[model samples]
Target chain A: MKMTPKAVVIGSLLVLAAVVFVAVILPYADTNQTVPSEIFRSRVSEEAAGRLIYIQNGCVYCHSQSIRKVDWGLGADRIAQAGDYVEDHPILLGSARTGPDLSQAGGEHPDDWHIAHFINPRYTRPVSIMPAFEFLGMDRVATLTSYVQSLGLKAADRRMERQRFWKQEAIKAYEAGPEANVRWLNENVPQGWRDVPNPYPTTEAGLARGHVIYQNFCLGCHGPVGDGMGPAQPWIYPPPLNFTILKGREVSGGVLYYQIMNGITGTAMPYFKRELESQKIWEVGDYVAVYFINQSDANSEPRGIDAAWEP
Target chain B: MSNPSPTYQTAKGFCLTSAFWMIVGTLMGLIGATELVAPDLTKNIGWLVFGRVRPIHINIVLFGFVTPGLLAAAFYYFPRLLKTELYSERLGVVTVVAWNIALVAVVLTLMLGYTQGREYAELIWPIDVAVIVVFLMVFFNFIMTVKQRTEPVLYVSVWYALAAVILTACTYALGNIVWRPSSGALVGIPDAIILWFYGHNVFGLLLTPLSAGVTYYVIPRSVRAPLYSHTLSLLGFWSLIVVYTHIGTHHLLQVPVPTWLKVIAIVDSVAMVIPVMAFLINIWYTAKGRLGEIHADIGAKFVFTGTIMYFFVSIQGSMMSLPDVQRVTHFNNWVVAHAHIGVLGFAGMIALGGLYYILPKVTGRPLYSRLLADIQYWLVLIVSIGFTVVLTIAGLIQGNGWLNGETVYRILPQIHPYYVTRASLGLILVIGAALGFYNIVRTLFVRSGEAVT
Candidate 1:
């Protein structure tokens, strides 16, 4: 096993070339994803710059940029495809998920939520293990938010458009006092949903479990007192639904269950079906029915199939 | 070149402690895996929650167990190969104790629910500091031993061992953000970026280097050949550091971070195959003509298997880093598949191999039973492969189900079967760990041990 300098040098060069080919050359040959020109794609240069920051910081470790057919029931709007990343050079598909996916993150929240999340995850999500990007500076943070907002591409543009439209309306109603704001929010809920009565029973155990679920999942959005003014409310446009608004209304178990499970997609109320179970949904709905709405039809007629454990 | 004979007693002491940690850590892994299947099976105790126990299992195996176990073997062999006795076995023992103390703190905090909640970085700031101290101590001991070496030439293994300790120490400090006791973070998105960079590096650079170091030492030594190519070895070493360092950002591609940074991460992640394949080719080639020789020695057999696992993990890791591939794998058991393959499959195998290789030399006695070690090895290999398969399927089911807009409840029945299978496979690993503990104890403590001859 005699070692020769020539063989050694040749081996080193081969490995070196291989590294260079993949790291530099391959990326150049690949088609890079860019914003579409057809859809009012005004590329916020700042957001584009922030996308670079996202790339640099490894935020993809915890977040994802692609939604799929599996995500629709989880309240996702669209599934990702090759066309979505047509302009991406080194597509931002990340591994390791210490956090949630963000493919359709645009218009999910206002720029303020992005800012808060980027600065420190804990401020937005009490249990967030996603680290803060504040060290990257406000300029960089702004760029990263822009990139996050651009995740869904054309779909994101549409959502952002909706968000912008509703944001103006929300602000106006918010400025007009709580009564007017509640009225505006209820007006947005389809009449059927507004009339739907709670169907599940409000058992003590169910309410207890619901309290825990609410704290873990909903408290961050709907405040402890059922006021929409949760920590994330400021950053959320049409802020979280003030649960109190539904008080004495005809809100039902099915409606609350649907809202909680499906999430008002164009709004900040994310679907919980993917993260929570059926029992959890039913329990949380019951909790809101008894505690927040102050009126519930949970245990009334047409109670569906009574769960095995229920009396 | 020799002073008054140093007793093998010091080396013996470190070996015993290391073997203990290795066995305990593996048991923890078994428990953690089982818990995933039957969440409420363990009395629903807060201390044993998957959230708490999983991290403890991982941390103990990585820090308390594998690192020390491998370092014990490294310390014993590094000095001998360099024609010098260890600079201070006492310091090595102290580091071992400190590491165990850190493990104790980690388990306690996790059980008490005092976690930062980040995957792998669960320990609070104080424990974080303890970890840094332990790493620094280990590094200082290794460096001083190298300085005191009688051998003029530094081997490739020496370089890897040195780089592992030094780089890991720095990464730990920066990743933990030891300065911020309350939060251990920067204010926002930048912090997530920094945290994962350090997190992935823990596996990518630190564990990778240490395992590779042992592989380099074992392959040639067992095959009775000079290293195939020292220059290639060094090249692989440096390239690993370069590519692995930046690829951590690949973990954050989906975030609001800069696209350019994401580009670097994705590209580097793909480029990772270069260093990965290079090392694999070099090692596999070195062992090519001597497969019989490798099989003949039980120690080399384990080490060889470890190298193969390393190949699987690295390839899987690279693929998992791809955005397209991540669409299916991220946030699912697929990454968990990668984690177990990397930690338990690759690093765990390497640590065990190092321990077995050095045990006879350190104890002056043969293994209690070659058959037992062989059985243990097969058990670990088969079970881990099964784990990889079962967990990957579960992750896929979850990923695809969620992506399809299917309700989470709908997918439960589909995924439960895989969970059961994974738990069953985990039991095999647990059995192997227990058997390993018995074997090591017999070899170390039992007198008149049976010899291969």
Candidate 2:
């Protein structure tokens, strides 16, 4: 084969054009024909503005929006669909999961929690490597927050609706003072969970483990002394329950356990069911009872047979 | 021949450009790595945020360090092979200047949080145009040089270089969606499909082909041997364009893309072995019995080692493209490891090799210090392998943990140690870049003395 300049140049470009037609153009035609998924809706002006901010900050580098079937175990509620992103100018299905997938991140938390997180993710998640967006100022952060809170589209709106309704109830309880707030919170727990004692006894080792969990997961909002005056207090309203107020209120081990595991949805508290296991939750509940409220029914009353591993 | 001695200004300029920017590029990478280790390390410093720093590191390494280094060698090799001077050194110099200005603009714009936000396609619309224009400028310079050649037959290296420049010019424009300036992307799934296609081409058409061209030139010339097989060379060139271009869809396989597209990507990704092996066999066979000759030349030594890394990276790439393999590899540091091996170990090594090979030839002097070049070589080699090992382990921990139902946050502590190791390794790489900069600048400017940084 004579390696002429024309042969090399013309032949290679022709090959490239043909491949582009097959690999690129053909796929574009096929995938572009997708209809909107059920939850899909056009972005409003606020969401559009926030989406631009998301793009500008390169947030897609760390966070992903694409949820897969395998993510169901990791608390995924919905699998991503092509049509869900119909209006996105550049669909930001990121490559890495340096952070969690955000396919349904909208309404996962209240606006105030998002604000504190924007100021510093460590304010909510102790070990989060996400950078602070405080430099964006409150306005831009709020804008970015709006975009984040709209991640699940219509499903997100439905979640946000529930959040708004519960938020008003939570605020009303909070303003009625600590006594009423504690009663209301305690009553919300199921009858079965309300009566279930913290099955695990409080040991020094258990207290240590609970302390570590508290700092990592709770101190951001609840403060080191459980006073709820943490750094994120200014942003999160109905302010992370003043744990000091639960004393003499007959708040059982089950109430602590349930709140920690299920979280008060309307306020800033997030459910840790996906993050913490059962034993850890029990241990943490005992830790709080002994230290913060200065009371514990752990290993008391209706005491059944001890577990094989209980020390 | 009264033309101021044909200073090879174009090649020398690119040599300096590549050497200088390697420091900046590697520094950005080090910064990003440090943030991963200690996210608060640069807290609230908007310009230094990890997200912004990451794109700076990637784009600079691609357009700044590797591309210019490979081009330096191509500019030197083109005239020699064609038996004529460059078509216009003046245009070449303008292109280099514009390239540096554009890189500066890239850093500024991205730092200011003005980006289009697609990986490998993050550059704003204007910078995208700058990239395509310069590539076309480079193509014009090379193709014109080819036309006026006293030599009639084009070497395989020339084919790779010409095809690379022209193909990348077209691919860059298409991939970047230069036609859509405001957003620089299509809508929805099509946008994602196009972005990955363009992202992969950033490597396939640009870095891979340029690295192959340098390997073809440096390996045989170092051993004073003719290419072991011309047929293998042709096969490699054509197969690369066809096969590599089809596999960008592999990056989109896990997404909600059409199943047919994923199949094409998977099948073609595995088929990538043909082009990779063809190029390797030809180069390795040429250097087979002549390891001693290649070893004696520091330049050839670097290029040859890159070929070995290329073999590993391509094989790993093919395996990871498998759907089952991708289930474990996608959206994790496993892909990060693959990138480090490909960019740093394979193409980056070849780029530096070409830089070393051409520096003395273009400058008409021996390198300031071969020892520094050797040190830099080991530094990059260690960074490459070290990154692969550490990041891959981190990726496995992440992938398995995710599959096992642990949330991404719960696994943070598990990967912290690896991120720390990666950052430390990054420091060593940054030092190597500084050393390269000192050596290159001194060699180009300081006519005498050892490189005293």
Candidate 3:
């Protein structure tokens, strides 16, 4: 009848054992029943080979591979499933998160981007703490890039397919000169967005705010002069845009806003819509219009009937 | 047999010094928190930039302030429990002085931006060497002390304390790449692995063990009872070593590392609960009916609360390590939350406990004021809890925004208010830290003595 310490400890251990058996051990054993999506598949042999280097070097320390419903806001696509880890035994679900997650990282960028990033995160990200893998050498860096590219399994394959398809078009467009390439880029934007006018107008205050925003967010690629000659330009193909060329051209405000806000995908111009606000986007667009293009339509429009702010 | 002396005089100096550091560290932490919110709270003075001040705050609060403070307690008690004099109080003091020097170097390097640019490993290489040197000195002193112990039975607390010192001596060297100071790396990808392997272990091995060692030592003594199960204590200790060592690879799961290694990391991270909970259950049970005993002793109160914080931190740490859990926690302030919880909540609390536990006995004068100590205890508890809530909410918002492709700009407005709240809570901790430091320093050197009440 006595509640001895020994008895209490033993009983608690039993409960813990039961909990682990159900929560951890059971799921691990039932790997077969793991739900596989259309995106699920095994890693290619090359990717598998690259994984060895990943483990030996400790890449997982800074990155993670899984994305969840909550992660949809992080620009994530799909949630991870048990089937995605079917081949995994120990599972590299990291604890001490010193860096970003990598679970669903497939075809997010081209192979070259990985190389430059792996060589030194700062080269691409400017302020990254991900550490330089330059010592991994070009050959190993290439191998590491391959492994990182295979993170999403079949999902990565689709992205890779898209990249391959667009790469040919992009290369051909570039070969034809900047005029053809700019046309090719603009042509890709959906028709509606291309014709739309920038709703926000250019104001002095707006232009100043845009200048600050551009320095913090876009200066890494879009040069200080509004030309695409930022530090990361050489590393990126089709480089950053030369905004001056759009001067006096009939490029709609909507087109410029779309490119600035959404970023030209498959290029180094990452979408600033996530890091910047709508006001910031409008301000920066006005800045480019005034400084680079020598034009200002930002505040010029009384076009749309004021619904709420007309007072 | 000669009566075992209860005065515990030899460690009196350490008790005084540790208390002083706790107060100083907390003050720095408060200032650091203020800077986080207003940023220009100090008008952008070079000394107060978040970049410079944050590292100093962390180091002074951690190494300069907390770790040494805890080690002092460990030094005093481990020898007594084993029925031995510290192998050399002389060596102990030497370690303390050397540790202070390293901390000074940390503040200077951070201020000068002579940083290695890693989070915990921010101290440049030379100071890193000083840390290793201090560890070696402490290790030598403790191991010698244990070897000469008069007690026939080695308590679990001693085992943990010894393991913590020895492992830190090794892991710190490996993690910092102390050998190659020029670059402090092995080229590319391997360097990242090595650095993080050391980084997480700083928490898992060094801080965890030392904190647990102090807890084990203080629990039974404060409760006036023998440990519930010495066997379970040892099981927890050894299993911690087994599971914690290989889990470093979990940090790299998103990289192009080998799948097998990542598998090892994830499994072990989950497996970590076994050892973690083992220690928690054993300690919690040891003090089950001793709530009054714990509350009666300010030191025990800190340790008891620390044990609870450990429960939250370890569980959170385990969950964050999971791929599913990490999807929402990674690269955000969530990890920062874990860091503070582990460093400040769990380790920092125990460090204060260690100081208070030894203060009365060492000074032979009741704490300059038990009332002040109790006040400090509440201030710290409130501030720490506030930090956990605010930082966690901010992390969730940032993580969710990124996942939804909500754009970084859009997320800033959502979390700005949380940052302001965190800064305000930080001010509370800062005030508490200042009060604690003043009380401790006054206790150590002031002549005025209040009647023991």
Candidate 4:
């Protein structure tokens, strides 16, 4: 290896060219052949514009659209496919999950939830570290929401339909007066859940733990006094429920648990089943029952079994 | 040591450019880290948002801070090694001016949200071209210097410096997809393949080799010894280019990229130990029984510590590429920690080392303050290690929490403490950058009454 200027420059250049062919050219040949996935469709102009905003804002750095088989978060139902990104100029299969994967994020919530979320993620997600995008203004925020809603493509559309339907139902119930709203809320719970009481006996520790969960997950939307006057109240429609109205209106512990776990879909309320375990749901439900509703069905009548941990 | 010329205008220009940008780059990092702790700190300031600030921080550190620092050392050494003067001092100065202009454009466009949206490759087509053109300018100047060399045997540092500039020029154009001005990306998954290929190479070819060039040049001279092994140098240089170029796909291992490509990236990533150990062994052995000399020189100390960081980061990289380990590390702050170690701890440390090593020689003056230089070194070293430890813990908490079905939202509160600690450390790093700039400017510009060599 006689060291020469020619050898160093030309030799390294040749190595780079060859590697680019194999690592870059060959893989491009293989992956570029993929057709559209079933959920894949060309974005509408609005969605495309929103994609630009997403790009501009650098959302891809934190919110990944790429879902792996090992993932247990949102969009875990569908493993990402090469076909899924056939139309993306620069596929936004993001590298980090600082936030949830937006692959199937479209239709996960109604557009209203997204709007409120974009303005200040803390409004809807009290614990969110995502920066407030209120500076993007209402129009850009709406556009950004559309792009997020278009994440799962056709799969997202189906979810959107469900959200719209639920949104209408929720608004109608709210307009029907507090009695009707409480009745509709509890009526929606499965009969078995409606009959079941909070399984764990309520204790001071449980309430304290439940208080922490409330502040972390609910206080932003539901308000400090649980009157649904939280900061996000102005943005959300059929706004976060006014818990005081549910008092003495057949709001059982099970109804509270069911509502918390399943969430009032179509509104800004997101399902907690993905995040909260059964105990957390029960605890938070108990907290709401005792503190907000001034009612308690916990550890009373038809209780199946006492948990060992109860003190 | 030899002074081929009385004036080193190009080296001085680059030394100043590196020092100035280091503060801006570290400040951006501090902003991004602070946002993680207090998302509402910036409130409605859209331009200061996390997404935009993050890329600006990364690009500036890579191109603005680290590259120029290494180039400053290269400019000083190229002429010294060749036993001749630089080919064109005027051309070298113009490149410095153009490089700073491009860096300004990088900050402005990204702040205004003019980006291609790809990490590491985020600069739009125009900035990308500017980057390549400037790199070409550097390569042309160096190669011309090589052509007119009085010395027959080209030093190992010369090889690395030349290869890094040329290879980065080509890779920058290719990865950025300079042909496609509208998007600067390929369609579909291939876009990801190309992006990581270019992304990993940014570190693999650009930073690693440039840092290696500085390390190879500075250490042996500081220790007053010939290289421990010519065979090891040959083995290290060629193996680095070969193995590093193949492993960029390791970033896409968890993605929907082809299985065969993933296999290649994994195997090559693991095989990367060959080049890494070769370089480290060569340098460590060269410095053997010469700890006192290395310690006495502020520059050699930083470079040597950088080698230790490189060893940790590279080993961590190899292990991380494993599918099982990636299940926990990928797409999280563990990778962030790994990156901090590689860029800030390894290459960044070496860049400062090279800059410090050449500062007095370029200016023909003593350092403005030895104590201040030592303080900057300690601040940087502490910040890098602190970031790695804090971010890795946060990443593990997130990764493990997610694996057991904990939502990202549920775990935010748990990691807030670590994020706070990271931001606190980032503040120290910014202070370090500011102190370094102050030290460098004073050393280069201040008229001191002290004796001049």
Best by lDDT: 4
List the candidate 1 regions with Cα displacement exceeding 4 Å: A1-311, B1-14, B448-453
The residue-by-residue lDDT of candidate 3 on B1-453, one tens digit each, is 334554443355555555566666666666655644443355425444444566667667767666776787888776777787777777777777777677667777776656554446667789888898888888788778776778866677676667677677767776676877854544333444555666677777677888888899888899998888876786787688767776776776655445666787788888988888999989989998888999999999999999999899988887777887776777677877787778888988998898888776666667777888888899889878888888899889977777666643345556677777877877777677667777676666656455544
**Between 1 and 3, whose TM-score is larger?**
3
Worst window of 10 by summed lDDT in candidate 3 chain B = B183-192
Q: Tell me the deviation in Å of residue A94 in model 1.
A: 12
The model with the greater DockQ, 1 or 2, is: 2
Q: What value does the lDDT take at residue B276 in candidate 3?
A: 88
CAPRI rating of model 3:
incorrect
Once all C-alphas are superposed, what RMSD does model 4 give against the true structure?
A: 1.5
Give per-residue CA lDDT, model 1, range B1-453, as digits (tens).
455565544456555666677666767667766654554355325466445566677777888667776676677777877788777777877776777777788778876667665555667899988888877887787778777877877777776777777667767877777787875654334455566777887886578888888888888988998887776786687788778877766766655456676888888888888888878888998988899989988878888888888889888887877888876676677778877778878887887888888888877778887888899899988987888898888889977776665543445557677877887877777788778888888888775634443
- Put the candidates in TM-score order, highest first: 4, 2, 3, 1
* Candidates 1 and 2, the one with greater TM-score: 2
Ranking by lDDT: 4, 2, 1, 3
Clashes of each: 66, 0, 49, 1
- Interface RMSD values for all candidates: 11.1, 1.2, 11.6, 0.7
Worst 10 residues of 1 chain B by lDDT: B36-45
lDDT of 1 at A139: 75
Question: Pick by TM-score: which candidate is best?
Answer: 4
TM-score of 1: 0.65
lDDT of each: 0.69, 0.90, 0.69, 0.91
**Residue A234, model 4, lDDT:** 92
